[model samples]
Target chain A: MNQILVVDDDRELRTTLVEVLEQEGLQAVMARSADDALERLQQETFDLILLDLVMPGTDGMTAIPLIRRQAPRTRIIVMTAYASVQNAVQSLQQGADDYIVKPFKIDGLMLTVRLNLQKARFCEETEAADLDKIFNGLANGLRRQTLQLLSRQGQMRFMDLVRALEIEDHTKVNFHLKTLREAGFIDQTSDKFYQLTTNGQRAATCLSYICKSLEASAQARPPIVP
Target chain B: MNQILVVDDDRELRTTLVEVLEQEGLQAVMARSADDALERLQQETFDLILLDLVMPGTDGMTAIPLIRRQAPRTRIIVMTAYASVQNAVQSLQQGADDYIVKPFKIDGLMLTVRLNLQKARFCEETEAADLDKIFNGLANGLRRQTLQLLSRQGQMRFMDLVRALEIEDHTKVNFHLKTLREAGFIDQTSDKFYQLTTNGQRAATCLSYICKSLEASAQARPPIVP
Candidate 1:
């Protein structure tokens, strides 16, 4: 069962929300204020947080970053009065995943909660796999160079890549080519030209960013003290 | 010229830092505290922010999210005393991009600032191009279904794809195939099979996540009351 934290100052509302959540088979926890929510966040892991925007102390907007820092993976949903729909939008800009207005119907709130939770789960599942593939594909210098070359040239023949990469051994070039092909960063055209797959293009873009940062750092290095 | 904001409680330190940054060809603005920094953030856009972790009111750690919310693209580097190295790390967790120890060398600070600015520029340049390509490629239903089909089947022939997609018109399938190929999502094999490029696979994964969220939202919708 997914764990949820409900942070609101109104005792009656909190009780009602918790009862509704529990009946829906979700594990629900409550906090009377943002401070209380932060404390609980530090001690426990939650799948989602329902935050009230106008808590007495450490209002929801201020608490967002603190809460996010403690639970980076957890989803946050800000609850605000109907009149403060603007604050709800601001809350999203400030890192809250979604928002619900006060006097929200139980069904409407549940729909929003379920949608955000589903998104969270989806992100968690795909992020790791995608990151692993991208990082692993770019780990080698030759691989990185190949991606850059393909990105610039659009496509190349096998021998062309070998010449561009300046690797003497054909087998060595072939080995890296196989690796790239397997990693899904590069593909061969029907006529035998080598080119970046869509992911390869994205990886190449990332590589350029990394190169720029490294170059900036290298250029900015100061002379060592004698 | 890149704009920078320097947030510090100490007037002397703030002035010195701004002078150094100005000398390096960056436009620098000063804030006396986190509250002051937030006010400036609201008024002007910045390429980077140099934040002091400790201040009298609304310290740097708390200011990070607020600053980020205001200027989502700005790079933030936290400044802290040597004794508070841990807080610098915490600042990063709270969304600061980098941190530097105070009572520090001018050369070091310049290096950090330049590196972060380079990264920020790189992100801005690549994010738009990549997102446009991804969104455009996924905009059509046929294109989306084609990606899903390729993702599951690994590779398919032209006729095979037509049959699998359950489309009687080969011309329609061919049109969509050309679209996907141009979008860098698919490649044709030497043996005449069609397969997703690495980027295509990533797109498929994203497509799956989007589908799951839509499905969840649809299921959670309340029944229409007459």
Candidate 2:
């Protein structure tokens, strides 16, 4: 038996999905609000989660990472009526397994749901294989250094940032910072002060420790799992 | 050598793409107008065609079947800024090999082109696999038929349509239509007129045809591909 959590503010849409998923022999849980959805996540695990983007508060974007933490094994599929390439790409970047546009076929929807599930069946095996690999260590080295410095210093000024890094060009440093900000790893204040946000700090603290300790193991990694 | 034709009214994008694809070692060709593209098609056989949906004169939807019939071996990939599941599914049904949402990563664009090319590579070894087999078959069933009929007819009155199809209840058909319209397949003018437009027709036609043929083929040894 599979459990699917559907979180959408639209009562009719949410309820309809519950009925549909139920017909498919999956225990479909409906959450009319993101807060309620998060509460459900804390209580039990789901096989898959269907999240709606336009919600009142703690919208899909904010909820994604938390859901990733709570139900690390569950595949998350984001649904949005206001579909854009930027949004789709961003959702995929945020670790969503797949996305379904609002106006979709019963067949296309079912196909995506089925494909996600089938893909999930073998995901962990491949994920484990990739998690055992190296190569990206050198690629992410500068970003890690930025994170580490931020964690140790609490906050860093824009001008001081450029001087400390080996890179001389301010433009290159700014590019890296922009990438970090976009990826939700760091934040910049109005004063041009760069610091980790609550979520960013938490992730950084945990990830930094893991990477630091696993530096040698990182070097010995094999080919990644696609 | 695989000849890749890029069709777009935008000179800048077309120029950039030709440079990019040629740099990647592909036999790239560009057409500013549908007429020009047809002319190019006559002079040479391309392995792939990249089309822009919103264009002056004949757009992607209008050009699809023409290209499909003219060069059955050629794969078409549609590009659009507006990314909808409806369009994605429709383009697939229209014998389009794939789609790339606009303002996309150059990498994503290249990867999709390469991936489709790679898949078509096997089509040479296997003679029977037509675009219909690879794109749309019986994946959606009645829903595809509903979309196709609506697309081809341009518009139909709801009550009259239900009677024509001999559906028992009006609400069920209406609900399904709402979903289809939302998916961008069908558009209703005022309360009475429903039209198929380009996006709607593409997805509806081929999918509907493939499904009916499959059903018809079930009793036979196998469905013959033509």
Compose the digit string of candidate 2's lDDT tens values, residues A148-226. Answer: 5676566899778778777888998888888777666689889879998654553343332222121212223342222
Clashes of each: 1, 4
Q: DockQ (Cα-based) per candidate? A: 0.02, 0.02
lDDT of 2 by residue, B97-196 (tens): 5678898889999888876675455444332222222122212334444654454344688876777667799897787777666666678788767776
Q: What is the Cα-based lDDT of residue B69 in candidate 1? A: 44
A29-71: candidate 1 lDDT, tens digit per residue: 8999999998776567898999998889899899986675456
Cα displacement (Å) at residue B166, model 1 = 50
Residue range B1-226, candidate 1, lDDT tens digits:
7889999999999999999988877889899999998887666778889998889999778888667545555788888884342354345435566767777899989887887777676556644455445556666667867887777566889998898789999999999889889989899899999999866765665553333222222333443211
Highest DockQ against the true fold, candidate: 1
Error of 2 at A69 (Å): 32
**Model 2 steric clash pairs:** A133-A222, A134-A221, B154-B195, B155-B194
| B-chain TM-score, candidate 1 | 0.67
The 10-residue segment with the lowest total lDDT in model 2 chain B: B208-217
| Cα misplacement distance, residue A115 of candidate 2 (Å) | 23
